[model samples]
Target: MLQATLRFAQTAYASTKRLFSNLFFEDALGVETNRPVALKDLGLAHSDRVDYDPSPWLALRRILPRNEVGPDDVFADFGCGKGRVLVQAAGYPFRRLIGIELSPELHAVAGANLDRSLPPARRADVELVNKDVLDYAIPDDITVAYFYNPFAGAIFANVIDRLAASVRSRPRALRIIYVNPVEEAAVLAAGAKLTREVRGLRPGKNWSLRKSIRMYTLAPPPC
Candidate 1:
């Protein structure tokens, strides 16, 4: 009984933290990204895609510091739902920001959110593509890629293969920020090295997998 009570308390605290964080960030940024969307609602219930749940506001900053983002770095958010990460990334000095989403509804919402949230002086060139991630080719100039466990199984493997292929061709430094890395093995198999692991924000001995973030770097192939 004592253990159960402790678990409940932990869960409640995490939920409260998420709620306030979302409220604060969304309001401060002038964007609406806290709402959750089901795959079924977006007509992707039968597909391999997962529902849309924005990552914590501070997740990106916690992993990649502002100074670490170079002027040449082009960031892409695979399956960027409602552009929460994209908006957060806009504060950085990335050369460009790209968001690829399979759902047209979410893509539209992401575009709108970016327009409202991104500052006029933001240097990144923002692009929101409404298409399947598998169909979208990973640009060679992209140095950073972010994923929120967008998809799993064969699809995730295929995407990683494309990312690796891009690195093989361009031979540039690549960093992949994967939140809730359910398919981390696929990334490692594609020759990416895990550089960092960030647990959930909730304070406890037990951390939720859904709130974790992993950072990986893919090196260019041997000369």
Candidate 2:
């Protein structure tokens, strides 16, 4: 009980502190870019929440601690809003990092943030594409994919289908890492095989929202 309380306090503190770094993030609501990505656009559907939380992308914090991923891996973040996940994930050892974000404005903000955070000498292989996740091809080289419940179960299902196809084309080298994965897990568990269940990804209890983050491997179907 004490530990959970302490953890929540610390997490809240950290999040608040980071907010001080950028006021737009700290004080603003959603609805950015030319169109779409709007928290209210009926088209964005389930993406309206715009959680924008980066805890799930801390590779060493909760993901790789239980999974077999490494620094040289390739990562793709679907619905990469503001590119925070990609930028945070880059701190790891990935050889190539990519993000697909539909909102041109958010993509530009993410690009700017990445440029500000990462030196030009170190950003040779990281890139973010301004494209819809459904239209973008799932790169065969992406070993790990991330989702933060960015879409409805239906949209997530489509992404899972594409991810599964990519794995079938390559077999055992692919992994799906989902944060705040209640809805996303439905799509993954139905399509992809479970590799491991990670519990420490979300902040400890006594906090406002409770979330589950899981890791799964999309292996080939039975022969």
Candidate 3:
């Protein structure tokens, strides 16, 4: 009984700490991205699609180190709801940032957030597109892609295939940052090599799989 009570207390403390940390970042950046919205609420009641949840700030910082990013690299977020990742990517020296959101409502919110948060100089390089991922062609210049379990099954496979094709055509290094990688097999099937995995830890340092993020690199086609 004592052990169970201690565990519960630890979990509660961790949750509260996370909430305050997220609020602090949002306030510091002057952006509102902590809200979670359901797909059905946005009229996207699809079995394969998940709801809109902003990626944790810590996860992004851990996955995309500043030293790894270059001026020539272009970053794209596949299900960039509310532009949280795009806003974070703007802090890097990437040549451009693209956000692809399927829901028009969320897309509009993301655009507004970017307009308000990003500096004038960096605003021009950010682009937000409201279209299905499968229909939209992955830009050849996109060197980094971010996904947060946007969709599964055939949709996920098709998107990975498109990423692979883009690499084949342009022959450039492509890095995929997949958060909550439920359909990771599809990425491996497209010949991507797992570079690293970042796991989230709760209070007491217990790992949580649900908050894990996986990084994969797709090599350019050989000459």
* Predicted structure with the largest lDDT when compared to the true one: 3
Extract clashing residue pairs from model 1. Answer: none
lDDT of 1 by residue, 1-223 (tens): 8788878988898688777976788777778888889989767874568789888888999899899998999999999999999988888889998999989899988978888876666623898889888888778999999999888888889989998999898898899999989898999999899998888756455556667899999999677
Which scores greater on lDDT, model 2 or model 3? Answer: 3
Any idea what lDDT model 1 has? 0.86
lDDT of each: 0.86, 0.65, 0.87
User: Candidate 2: how many backbone clashes?
Assistant: 2
Model 2 segments more than 4 A misplaced: 1-38, 41-60, 70-72, 188-191, 200-209, 221-223
Give per-residue CA lDDT, model 2, range 1-223, as digits (tens): 8888888877887676455534543123221211224544524434434534444334334665524557658988887877666666666778788988776767787787777667686566787898777788778778888877676556677778777777788765677877666665565565666676656423545332335567777667778
- Listed in order, each prediction's TM-score against the native is 0.92, 0.71, 0.91
List the lowest-lDDT window of 10 residues for candidate 2: 26-35
Say which candidate scores most in TM-score.
1
The candidate with the higher TM-score, 1 or 2, is 1
